[model samples]
Target: MHPSAFLRLAALLALSLPAHAQEGMKQQPAASDRVKEVPSIEAVGLSGLKPGTILFTDHRDDPAKPENGLVPYLDWGRVRPAERAALAPYAGYAEPDYLQTLNGVSKRRHETLKVYVAQGRFVVPRPADSIDLASYATLGFVAKMDPVIKHKTLNPADVTPTKDPAAAFAKRPDRPWCDLGTVCIESRYDLEGKLPLGVKLANKLEDGASKKVAEFVSFQSELRTLPPAETAPLAGLTKIDAPVTGGLEQTIFWVNQILRFGKFLAVFQPMPGDPAKTVVTTYMALAIKADVLDRKQEYARVPVLKNLLPAQVLMGNSSFNTGTSISAGLPTYARNRMTAFADALAKN
Candidate 1:
């Protein structure tokens, strides 16, 4: 049976028992109380399941701590900004111009190169002076298990927080259900709610069927609805109508865009050939709309994410082939820029 379902059953069992009979037994909190604290659209209880029976635990409230009750190495605040920035550029934004120096070529050759070598490679030409806005949504996966926490053995200053950050994070730990290996899974929750967004992209890539790839690309195009909060503003922008081409390249683009504009969330790429594989890998991102340049107050409100320590389940060999998986940290320049933006916005 699905671990989530099992968890629900366990929770139900814990709840259904007589109060007097349960008095000697461990007292489980009421479901409503848990829900009020967690504030999730989805609800699940897994107290009845034996150790190791539960799959995913909801950890949205406390990313640093494990949902199943383990202490994690880091929390969301420590890692979110970096991950968002790493995922940002992949969304179909204009790549910055590269200044190349021709050591061996003459002035004439350099001029010639300029005519042919327009700034960056043209997978798609960015809209001139305008931002492309697409409707975006996100689905997060939560785990029920607690993470094993690791603290720095040495302290920079012989000081600790009067209050524990880990305890603060775990205060309201509820989220959409996930399995042991997958925690805090983020994806484009299709606005129409008809198709599985990110999973479909992974499946098409794995099948190696070009025709399906094209269809998947088309599906993404259809999924470009307006974000719930920013629909009117996004509708005013020019919509790019070109069909997204390329295999993984197109997939990466869509994923990146979602990260940037939708919710500033990052997603894990599946293995080269396995469709079922959905593990968060490297390449974090930071995406901000051009308009945010002017609206300091709105931009300042954007949250800073840091200290992203993914669960152990996210680590390990790819299910597809035992190839070396890719992981990346946010670029220094990108981090600096985002921090600057946030700082400027705050000041303004």
Candidate 2:
């Protein structure tokens, strides 16, 4: 690291130490001891016998030197022509653009970056028929986000979004959060019912061997995360119980949230090398609230912060990761969420 960068990071750590110390005064574990738990895509896949992949497909960053060289980041624009052609039909809209920048966020409310994208691929060997395409028709797409409070269910209805930000703030009403001008909440849908205005969608997939057409399912719902609390961060995770779309086998899911918009999909087909096993190709893209990047770019630009903090920062595992800037938080969350979704589909 450059001397200047080291100084900047040191200053940041120094500035944040007092608050971390203050929290310790409350009798909770030391900030460094806290660890948020998240379902790892790899772990989930192995648990259900599935293969998964996560790549950083962001057009803005250099793939040669990802945040820590461990984070999976891929940009649609950066893909080679041949690889791009292979994934084009399925790629759809999951690539990120470097040019948009999403600048002017805090200063002028400018959204310079066209999007903050995330991508993941996974394989579920089970035939599409084994997956519960119908029940997913009314599922709460937010549940699979698998980052904050993690997976709670497929239900979407019975969740009423809170419109009063002040009231939500009051629920936990902790000082550091309000003092910081924001909070994170959890999206936990455990009830069963039809999502408001949700609809069932069907699609056709050709069986490569038989040349026969098969049916696939997708659905949409108006979902709300569980009420705000200290344990799970939900503020801005959704656009006030945003309307989301999802599906099973040949899986797809998209969420429209206030802070971030995410879309992920997996295409299942027979693997060429092994005719008996199925190969699933997956992709996803998303955009985040510009103003956020504006405020936290300093912390996000740090390498150690980006690497060690992605999953922790996202799942709100600890107050420290929760407090660090999460500008590059999507990849870890994406990988885990995609795997969780694939595992669920494999079971159904």
RMSD to native, candidate 1 = 26.7
Candidate 1 has its poorest 10 consecutive residues by lDDT at: 112-121
Which whole-number lDDT from 0 to 100 does residue 168 have in model 2?
A: 28
Candidate 1 — what's its lDDT? 0.21
| Least well predicted 10-residue stretch by lDDT in candidate 2 | 195-204
Q: Give the per-residue lDDT digits (tens) of candidate 2, residues 209-290.
A: 2222111112222222112241022111211122112222222122222132333444444443443444443444444333
TM-score top scorer: 2
TM-scores of all candidate predictions against the true structure: 0.16, 0.38
Over 299-348, each residue of candidate 1 has an lDDT whose tens digit, in order, gives: 12311101111111112111111111111111222222222222222232
Given candidate 1, what's the lDDT at residue 89?
A: 25
Residue 344 of model 1 has an lDDT of: 25
lDDT of each: 0.21, 0.32
